[model samples]
Target: MTATLTGVDVAPPAAPAKRRRPVPGWLAVVPLLVFTAIAFGVPALAMLNGAFTVKDQATGASSYTTGNLTASLQGAYLTALTGSVKLSAVSAALGTLLGLPLAQAVVTSRSRAVREAVLTASGVLANFGGVPLAFAFVATLGNAGVLTVHLHLTDHGWDLYSFWGLVIVYLYFLIPLMVLTIAPALEGLRTQWREAAQNNGATGVQYWRHVALPVLAPSLLGGLVLLFGSAFAAYATAAAMVGSAVPLVTLQIADALSGNVLVGQENVALALSLDMVLVAGLVMAVYLPLQRRSARWLA
Candidate 1:
């Protein structure tokens, strides 16, 4: 038998400390679900309905038909769609090519100030597109503008209101966005990997070609996809700069909604929106998989 201490009294074993029940993960997402339903789901349903339903001009009778979607795929609409796709491809390609090196430099820099300055600028410029950006470009690169006059770009056949100019404007933002997106991936590359390559008698080019490139492939592709989507859906800048000269899907959609070209084409605008959604969905599909693959390596 154990003897009790002279001046001490024991406290009762605290009624087994209560174990709090864990919160359900789904409960945490309820607010997000509600917001999504209200924001995206409702608008999507409305768009889908509008895309399919048509009203008779004289009778004001509404009926469902595939004509809107069919029309969206034909003639001028088709041309606009193709043109937007080509422009997006060109801008995204150029942005990726230019951004990769800049981002790589940022990641490899020894100076913190240089890296911070670049990243800060990129953040601002990536979100710097739209009307103001359009105006800025016009002021500098327009036919009678300062740079055009000074550099004699006019004599060189430069046209800021053309498709190529639109691509140039897109690159202005896209390259910065690429820099932002890919920098993290570049940073994820470990020194050990390079050391391992060097230990195997690999040159800098060989190390990148065999090892680093393989690791970064997913990230590069993902950045390209992001750039493509940004270029694909861009509206205000192109609208302000090129106007109807570009024949973009966005411009066509705007025209359809505003009835500038033709009245009673709102449903066609919705159909164009549906097409945009599909293209955006395809981009997401590619991006999500690449993101997951990169996470495995980078994380």
Candidate 2:
């Protein structure tokens, strides 16, 4: 009855508006660009400049020369480099060998308590470094250490300040790193694959060689590379244990910079840069293949 007087009411449809804010490409990279410039680029350039320049003792005049780089390529620096490389390789290889089994054991264990204990121990050992670990090893394996006292019982001797001793100490750190790295890789493996392999009558060794290895290789290789780098760059443990009696590249560089020789300051900086570049190159060489293989596997 009221329709005679009521006006028809209607609403217009809302328009579909475009997004007002778009992400800025340059803004996304700003933090990285800033970090590179401040943290790496500037310091790298400074070191490069210092490496080639000879400063006058009195006037401090700088003259560019290849003498420092040339000297570094020879003499103690070269020997130290070789030693560092050898030690790193040995430690990494040994660590991987030891860790793979330990990781497998931990991951495949039926006991949750054992797995928890292993993981906890690894986590603790991973962060253990410097004088404390060194002293602990020294007190256990040094000439006057607890183990040395028992060594005479077996006609064996212990010297915790030697190269092999350093390797053993390095293994303590490297094993934990290997476990931390490889255990996750092992755990990440799908149980279905193992079950399927077993269903096909594949032995443990066969499954490992064919199925598990291919899957785990990337992580294993990555862990080795990391261990090598850590061992190569190590100074504190070596210094505390053997001091300059065994001249590691890092320790030598530190000595050059801080020792009584004032002229070696710039050379030390140069040597450090060289060491950095060499280690970086070695890491990249190891990393690229693993990365490619990993991508292929994932793909």
Candidate 3:
């Protein structure tokens, strides 16, 4: 027998039909795809073509060849490549080491104003690079500079055009960049975790060693990769300060294109650019995995 309630509505309320977006999901991504194609893809393909092609000055004809890549890997070019790698590694390592503690201080600070002030300064300083940065260092540390003359720094063998001087300049921006990169990860450290560690009779050092470091390892390594890439790809400051005194791949690339040292080596510049792209790609490969790992832990 069927029974009906007098004042009841039991039809599941029509299940609240799903709302459709006015635009397709993929439509929103079209602009980004086009931009990437024009900006990165086109340039990359052009570089590849140029790197493998040789133009004859006599006949005005172009021929495909691998000699550009070969030339890029030998003699002075090889030295520049190695020097860039070394400089990048050193600056990135030092930046990470110094920035970590500073970020920790910001995170653990009791005063909000102090934290804000430091972070604001770091943000400004991190983006301070290129020509202005080089000039500032030169005026303060260069030969016949204010500090160099006033403090007898030149008397003590301080040279702003040297490799180490370039490293010091790189550290100026890199440390702040590291601080900015790693701050959010530092903030993600749960207070409950610290409290739990303390409740278990763990010392501060023990807590950091056994718990915090393991969690923060990914973020730290990721920051190092970022700094390495920054130092590796830097052009302007080094070009301005050290010029050709330091053997950097970027300088070599510039010389190749501008014929500063040799004429008709434009294709060689493309080959060097390709090498830089590969190095940058390697850094990205290492960074992506660490970033994903950090997101899982810190998120």
Candidate 4:
């Protein structure tokens, strides 16, 4: 029609393009959501449900009750909980304080091989836990162990099965863990901040106090909480190393579940597990906000 009517300069109008409907982006994460539901949600719900359930020994009847939870707050159980918290706090503090320098040293090192070796070692050691780790410490520091035989540590009243001993053992893994966690935050620290501070006549200590430490505080705190959780939930290492002698909440929970001390105590174990879950949840509740705040600056 345009060619036939070319002399008159007539043209037909173009057709409009069709618009496509928007796809829901969240659908892409459906598999992850499903996997999380199966992996974490279901188990957590089951554990929570069991924590509040009670079984009557006389009639073998089950009922909803808070007795187990209430019982968890009294006597030896409470002490165990307190002990776990104390261990976690001390270990996390030590790890954060000590690991920061190591991480900084690694970052500042000119040797790429040294940095790689340090990071690799940190990665391996951070994950070094459970039975083997316990055995390693025991073989190194036990009464008749190599170091003990060489130095006579037991003669000086240094027992590797005690609380302080447990802390020392925990530091093996904890320090490396903190190193891995805080190194990225340390790297995130831009050099310009330090240079600018120095140009403004600020000293090294002042720069670190006013700029570096303040910026790193949230990440360090977050790593501390993570370390605390790691230590709090630890079972195999402490159990294999010291057994019931340590009185950790994890051991208490294990004992309750095993029913060695008292029959039908699994419910109490569930209650203890619930208590741990709550504590961890409370910690994350505080940590997430700080992590978010840190991201704002880092980003």
Give the poorly placed runs of model 3, Cα more than 4 Å off.
1-22
Q: Please, what are the lDDT tens digits per residue for candidate 4 over residues 1-299?
A: 46564476556988988889899999999999999999999989988888889988999989989999998989999999999999999999999999999999998889999999999999999999999999998899987789999998888999999999999999999999999998888888999999999999999999999999999999989999989999999999999999988888999998999888898989889999999999999989978987898888788
TM-score of each: 0.92, 0.84, 0.91, 0.92
Computed on alpha carbons, the lDDT of every model, listed in order, comes to 0.96, 0.81, 0.95, 0.92
Task: Write the residue-wise lDDT of candidate 2 on 1-299 in tens digits.
Answer: 12333565545667989878988778989999999999999988878877787777799677888877776667777787778889899999999999999999999999999999999999999878888989998888877778777766225545667788899999998999889878877887888888999999999899999998988889788888988888887888898999867757777677777764455465655755676676868797987788677656644
Ordering by TM-score: 1, 4, 3, 2
The CA-based lDDT of model 1 is what?
A: 0.96
For model 1, the superposed segments whose C-alpha errors exceed 4 Å read 1-23
**What digit string (tens of lDDT, one per residue) describes model 1 on residues 146-241?**
999999999999999998999999999999999999999999999999999999999999999999989999999999999999999999999999
- Give the lDDT ranking, best first: 1, 3, 4, 2
Give RMSD (Å) of candidate 3 vs. truth. Answer: 5.4
Winner by TM-score between candidate 3 and candidate 2: 3
Which residue pairs overlap in candidate 1's backbone? Answer: none
Which RMSD values do the candidates have, in order? 3.9, 4.0, 5.4, 2.6
